[model samples]
Target: MDKHRNLDCKDIEAITALLSKDGEALNYYKTNGAESVGHAFMIANLLHLHANVSEASLFYRHAFNLHGKSQTEYPLPQSLLQVSLLCLLKAGQPVPEEEIKELEKYAPSYANYIRGILIAWRGGDVKEAMSLIGNAFEGFHSGEEIDALYLEIALKYFPALTAPITDTSYSPIPRHLYMYWDKNPPKEIADNIKYHQELLGEDFTFFNQENAEEWLFEHFGSETLSLFQNTKHPAESADFLRLHVILNNGGWWLDADLRLKSLEQWEMLSRLPKNCRFFITEKFLIHNDFFGTVANDPILANALLTCYVNMLKHHGLYIPYKTGPGVFSRAVSRTVYSSFNHDAPLPSLAIGTAWEMFSIVEEFEVTYKSGGNWHTA
Candidate 1:
C-alpha cells in the first residue's frame, strides 16, 4: 500500500472493490499492527474523494484511534482529529461526546468550530453559531491548516443558519446543460459528453477549446477573452468559462467528466425551485463543478468580478482561491452574510444537499488521472 501511495482513480476503484468484499480491508487493518494507521488515513482520503462518506468516516475514526495508540507521528494528531470530526459530520453521524471532549482538551478553538456546526445541525440560533464560527476563524492564523478548514466549514454550514425562503416566483433554470473540454478529449470524457447529449438531445451543448474561446469572444468581447486565454491551466480557464457562459446564457453548467446518475435526477432538477441561482454544497464548500442559474445573476456577477480582480491583482494566487470554489464559496458567504447584516430578505438561492448532488451526477474522471489534471499541472 505504501508503494501505491500515489494512487489514481483506477487504483481507488480497485481498492474500493477490494474493500467492499465482506469488510476485508477493515478486518485486515484490525489484525495488522498500529503502524498501518498512516495507511488507514490514506485509505480514508481515497474513500472520501470517491464519495464513500460512511466508509471514509469509519476509516478516519480508525486512523484517529490507531494514531492515539501508536508512537508514529506522520499523521499529525490535530489533522487526524479534525478530519475525523468533519467526516463524521458529513456522514450524518453523531460525533461522540468523548471525541468532543478530546477535541476541546487539545484544540479548544476547533472544538468551538465543531460546536458551531453542531448548533446549526441541531437547529440552534443562527446568529450564535455564526459568531462562534467567526471567532474560530479569527483564532487561526492565515495560511494555517485550520485556516482553510475554517473557511470550508463556514461556507458549508453558514447557509443552513439562514432562514429558508418561502417565495418561489423566479424563473426556473433552463433545462439546457453546458460542458467544456479540450479539442481532443480522452475517450472517457468524450463518452460522458455523448451520454449527456443522448439524454438531453438538442438541449445539450458541448464546448471544446476552440469553440469556448469563440463563445467567450462573442459574448464577453476581447478583454474577457484575453483573460480566459491567460489562464495557466485548462481547469483555470474552465473556471472563467463556466461563470461567463452561465451568466450570459442561464443554464446548467456541469463539468465535462460529470454524468447524470439517472432520469430521476433529471426530474429532480426540474422540480428545483425557480431561484435566481442553484448550487450544490459538497462536504466542505459549494462546488463550482455543477450549478445552474439565470442570466446575469448577482451571485455569479460577484464571482466573475472576484475572479477578474484576483487575476489582475493577485497574480500567482492558488487556483482554488483565484478562480475556483474558493472564490465561489466566498461569493456565496458574502451574499448570505450581507443580507443578514442589512436585515434584508435573503436572495432566492437554492442549495442542493451533498446527497442530492451525488445522486444527480458521478465523475468519470479519466483525463485527470492521465496527467491532464490541471491541479497537478
Candidate 2:
C-alpha cells in the first residue's frame, strides 16, 4: 500500500467506502494483492464515499501496467489504489488517466503499454480484455511477478466466466483435452492404462489441458497444444486434415470412416505404424433411409469415395466417387457429410460422384491411395 501513499485523501476515502460491502470487498482484494484479507477495511471506507467509476478505471489500468512492469519484488499499496480503479470500471463507468509528466509524449515503446490499457478498457469486455492481457503476458514475459498478478486477478473473475465447464451442455472443453480426470486416470480406465503401462511409462508428466495449462506453460520446452476447439472445414484444400493433424500432433492423420469394427480390423489397423498411418473406408456407409430411397444407394455410394468403397466391399465395380472436403472427428460435430463438396469438379473418368482419391491423383501428385496394397499409380 506504500506505493500509493501519494494518493490524495479524497481518492483514498472513495475507495475505502466502496470496499465495505462483501461483494465489492471481494472485488478489491481480487484486483489488489493476494495478502489482502484485512486490507479491505480501508477499501470499505473508499466505497462508502463512492468515487466516479470511469475516472478510477484509468488509474487501475495504469497501476496494473506499472505493477506488471515494476522491478520491485513485493506487493504494495499501489496495488490497492489500482483496485479502486478496477472497481470503478466494473461498475460500468469511465476511467480517466491523469496526464503523466513521465510519458507526456507517446513513444513507440510506450505505445505498447498504452495499447494494453486500451485493450483492458474495452467496453462490455473489461474482464475478457484483462484475462486476455494476462494470457498474452505468458507469451511475452517469463517473470514470476506479472504471472502472479495475472493469476490473482484471474482467480477473482474467471470462476463466473468458467461456469459453463461444469454444465456439460455448454462446455467447450474438447473430449481429447487433457481433463482433470485423466491425470490420475479413473479406476476403470486406470486398469486399462496399467495394461498399457509400458507404453505410457516413457515418463511424460501429462498435464490436463483444462486443469494444468499453467503447469504446461512452465514447461517452455513443450510445444504440444490441443487443437480440438474448432472443427470448421478449411476452404484451402482437401489436404488440410493431413496438415492439421501434423501441426497439432505429428506424422500422418488417417481420415477414417471409423467404426467399432471387428477386433481383426482393430489388430490390423493398430498394427500399422503410427507413421505409416491408416484410413478407414474413404466412403462412409450410413443408413440409406436417411440419405436416399432404396437399399441400393448407387448415387450416394458414388457420392462416397470410390477408393473407400473398393477398400471396404468390392474391388471391381462400376462406380464414381468423391472424397469429403475435409475429414472431421466424429467426437466433434457430425458435419463431415455436410462439408463434402456438392459442386466438386467431376473427373473425366467419373461423373456425379464424390471421387476424392482419383481426383487427388489426377491433380496433386503429392497425395496417393492404396489399391489392395499401396496404390502409387
Candidate 3:
C-alpha cells in the first residue's frame, strides 16, 4: 500500500523471465521462501504442464516438496483425493513417500488408494486400476470423470493394446504384423512409451459361410486349411491369424466364395506356394464396386451385416460384397489366364464395370465361371 512496496515489483519481473527454464523457480523458492502456497503451486503446475515429461516430473517433485503441503482450505470430495493422485500418476509424476506418510495423518483410506495407484502404475493390474478409481471420489461421480481423464492420458500417451485378439493357445501361428491395442489408455501413458511407435500395415483375410466351410473341409481336407475365428470375415481374418503379413511375402490370397472341388485343381498354388506374404485373390473383374457376398466370402459377407452404424474409412459403394473380386478386379484389371490350368475360364462374374487398375493383376490360375445352376467340379 505504499511507494516502497512498488519498488519490489521489478524483482518479480526479472524472476518471471526465467520461469520457462527448469529448476529456476525451485531454486528461487529455496532462496526466497516463496511468501505463500499459491506462488509455489503455480510454479509447479507451470512446469508440469509445459516442460518435457522427465523434466516436468522432476519439477513436480520439487513443487510439492517446497510448497510444504496442506494447501486445501476445504476438504475435496473424499474420493477426489484419490483422483488427484491418479492424475499425478498418469502424469508420470510419483507422489513422494514422505507426502504419502503426511496424508496418512489425515485419512487412512486415501493413503491406501495411493498405494493402489503405485501398484497399478508399476504393474498393469486391472484390479488396482479399478480400485484406485473407486477410491478417488466421495459424494458425486467425479470418479468416472477422473477415470475417463486418466484413461485418456494413457491412450494418448501410450499405444492402446486390447485383449489379445485371439489366444489360439498355440505357438506363433502365421503372422507378420503384431497388432497390440488397449481399447483406450491414459494420454500421458503414451508419452512414456516412446519405444512403441511403429507403422501398422493391413492384415488381409477371408471367410466363408458354415455351408461354405463344410464345403471347404469336404473338398480340401482340414490339414491344408487352417480354420480361425468362426464369426466371419474369414478373408481378412485369415490374414490376422498369423498377426500381419508383409507385402510381397508368398501368401496365397483367395476369397472364401471361390469354391473348389479340390485344392489341387488350381495350378496357381503350385508355382508360388508360400504362406508368408499376402496373396492377391483370383483377381476381381476390375474395380467394379461389386460385393463379395455374390462370391461367398463370408468375411466380407459378415462385414456387410454389422450393426455399429457406418463405414468410416472404406466408403466403397457396392450392392453386395458378393462380387468383391469383380469390384477389386476392376480397380486393377489384369486378366490372369493360366496356360497351366486346363479349366481356367475368363473372369466374367468377377468383372467390374469401373475398374481402374485392371491392367496389372498377376497372371495365375483362378477359375471364374459365369453364374450357373450347377456347382460342378
Give the winner by TM-score. 1
Candidate 1 lDDT, tens digit per residue, 150-269?
434444445543225454343477778899886788788888889888888898899988999899999889998899888898888888899999999888888887788876677667
Better candidate by TM-score, 1 or 3: 1
lDDT by residue (1-377, candidate 3, tens digit) is: 11221112236554344453656555655565434434544554555555434333333333443443453642232332343454566667666675566556656666665675676667666444444434332322211233233332222222211111232232211322122112232343232222212211243333223433443456545732343222134332332221111112323233222222232322222332121111122321222111121123322222222211112222232222222322222211111212112234422122112121122121223222233421211
Residue 94, model 1: lDDT of 77
Best by lDDT: 1
The lDDT values for all models are 0.69, 0.29, 0.32
- Model 3: what TM-score? 0.27
Task: Give a tens-digit lDDT track for model 2, residues 127-225.
Answer: 543433433332221221233333333323333311221221311111120112224433543443343233324321222324343443343223322
Cα RMSD (angstroms) for every candidate in the order listed: 9.9, 22.4, 22.9
Cα deviation at 338, candidate 3, in Å, is 62
Q: What is residue 190's positional error in candidate 2, in angstroms?
A: 1.9
TM-score of each: 0.61, 0.25, 0.27
Q: Model 1 — which ten-residue stretch has the worst lDDT?
A: 1-10
lDDT for 141 (candidate 2): 17
Q: How high is the lDDT of residue 351 in model 3? A: 18
Sort the candidates on TM-score, descending order. 1, 3, 2
